[model samples]
Target: MSKLTPLGSLPYPQPTDVADVPLHLQSLAEAIDGRTVLRFTDIANLQARVTNPVAGMVAWLGTPGRLFHYAGNHWAPVAPGPVHKVNNNEGSTTSTTFVETLTSATGDPMAVSFTAPPSGSVIVTVGAYTYNSAADGLAYMSAAVRLGTTVKLAAHEDRSSIVRSAARVSASTQFQVSGLTGGALHTVTPAYRAGGGAGNTASFDNRFVRIDPVT
Candidate 1:
């Protein structure tokens, strides 16, 4: 029986421990640097071909997001469509207070004609503002929709005279005006007075929305 012996093991040179070597396989402090940094060969290429690139952009880079920094550094929810402003300044003019007293054909008089939400009837908010400081115009004057002889909604004070000066508030908003009889021969009585005389003309431009009946 021939004695079986293990094949001679090749003795290869062993690499020395780099822990004691100064610059042998050891990364230099200058190469590492104190500041943390990530090297990228081609950012745009990686982004274009990267998986879930859109998600990466949203997470890493502040881009391709719906939110925006509109007013300040804080992020705000972006509106999908155009923003609608309910009111705007109509300017001021030297004029008298134009008071209109609306009457119901049956003898009950009211200012506005809004009863239901979807109805064509709308409530109007009339505000009086200063026209000219030189004219000593009224500072603040306002009124709201009145349904009948007794009911007055959103009542505000006329802090200053509305006649013979530039009115500060020429803006108005539409509200639902209802609860009164419709098609009752509504009549409106217009009256105004300037600072000097009863015949003085007062002018005011109001902002109003067109009434559309919803079926």
Candidate 2:
């Protein structure tokens, strides 16, 4: 007779039991037969080792230190990845065409880059302190969050004639972008434009862009 482990049901001989080599071998086989998680150096190593992983199989990736679970056809992250953020307060613009809110002295757009998981989604949040130049009609500032050149979220603030000219306001927008290519680098930028009126200068300061990858 023997006692068995509560979780894995592994058998161990008791004081009263006779020598049981077959039972001991069976217990050893069971111990290593079904592992809860497999460890690998990285994604390339994991794919090389696990060519035909089944559903619900879990793996630990060493390079990025993340956990992944196989979901029948593809490997999915067990949890959301790290968040990325960028902040700038040095630039202002009055361009009617949408342009980067943060830019270098060389006129290059400032951006935040992050790696996305396979078929994953990211939540993007963009915010800025905005100023609109005085005008007889409506004075407005329009801002947007862009994934590369594609605009994902856009927001605007309109100051009416009664609200005083040259008003400063806070504009922000948050949204999710999905269907991203797995293990690809993605960039996010905050952009702005002036309202469709003459002398309606739109300027932004103290702006930030945050990206949160979702599993």
Candidate 3:
């Protein structure tokens, strides 16, 4: 009969029974420690476990392949895995609001602003809504992702559809960019110009933007 030593530590502290040997080994595969095991748990449960966590504590979450490590403050995915971060503003209004400074209350930026990870690249998704048949009774909208003043992604509605105002429309697009310096700030925005319609005098509604990084 033999007992087992603690995990990740030196060998034996003579066990009192041979029967416990198989049980201890079974637990080793199921738990993180002798008392605590973390396998497939949701993000909420994962956060609850490490309420007073230290740096470098890691666990598999939500599924077998989803591994996360707890840094001092938050949980970060294990290396070689994609990391996602999102910033968005929501509300309702009836007016022409174009991209400007990041006045979230008014949606001046019309996009999500974020700090780039050390990866120097990220993918951005832009979403927005607007209603304006004002100009030529047609409404047009455009969107872009920018690394500082340099535009990385941009798109606009065709004049026929956008310029001729209908009901509000969901404007969404995505783009990937590289060569950015990690830890830099990036922004995405919505815009309108003289495209398919003279609908420059239209109105706008809800808008949002998001960015994801794959390193």
Candidate 4:
């Protein structure tokens, strides 16, 4: 009997087969990866090519070239299309504590301006910073999120730690807004309010905000 063997590398290899014409006497990786990249016009055509496919086998659809993995006797989509994001982080502003609420833009106008991603929801976070002695812990800093004058989210946190330093926090608040129209420029801003009307000044640290899509 003549012993079968693979005499060359794949994609154009010579094989003296023991029944597996394209995979005879090949290495483990070559034997598995060599003969399993099946191509077809679509799902229907793929079914016509092989009556039974082993689990994990892939089919590359010819029309759009999307890949699918076989499982539970069916081919399922195996690729995540894409992800998108939007951000705004710039400038700085102080806070004026009073009986009224404040917008994020007033503190740091640049850090609050962002364009919404096409027709998708976004997760937003805003930060309120305070510069205190850590002992004057009497200073209360609050931050809020707004889109073109619409208040989407708002929250407040307090800590008088003046330790003669600045601190940043989310004030235990976050927002998730949906139904964004594609290509629309929405101005996002973060504003702040301290304890005393003009008496309480929020330093630049209180004006930080971030926004990103939920996709």
lDDT of each: 0.30, 0.62, 0.52, 0.47
Model 3 ranges off by over 4 Å: 1-105, 134-140, 143-164
**lDDT per residue as tens, model 2, 1-215:** 87888886777878888788897778767665545788999988999988877777889999788888886667767875655554545455556556654333233365677666565578776666666665432333333444466655544343111112365666666667777755555676556666556656665566666778876
Q: What is the Cα-based TM-score of model 3?
A: 0.43
Compare candidates 2 and 3 on TM-score and give the better one: 2
Best by TM-score: 2
lDDT of 4 by residue, 166-200 (tens): 45433423567677543244544444444333343
lDDT of 1 by residue, 28-143 (tens): 33232312222223333334533332211211223322332121221122322211112232333234443332111121122333222222243333333224443543323333
The TM-score obtained by model 1 is 0.24
- Sorted on TM-score, highest at the top, how do the candidates line up? 2, 3, 4, 1
Give the higher-lDDT candidate: 1 or 4.
4
Residue pairs clashing, model 2: none
Query: How do the residues 151-179 of candidate 3 rate in per-residue lDDT, one tens digit apiece?
Result: 86654452112434546666655666667
Alpha carbon RMSD to native, model 1: 22.6
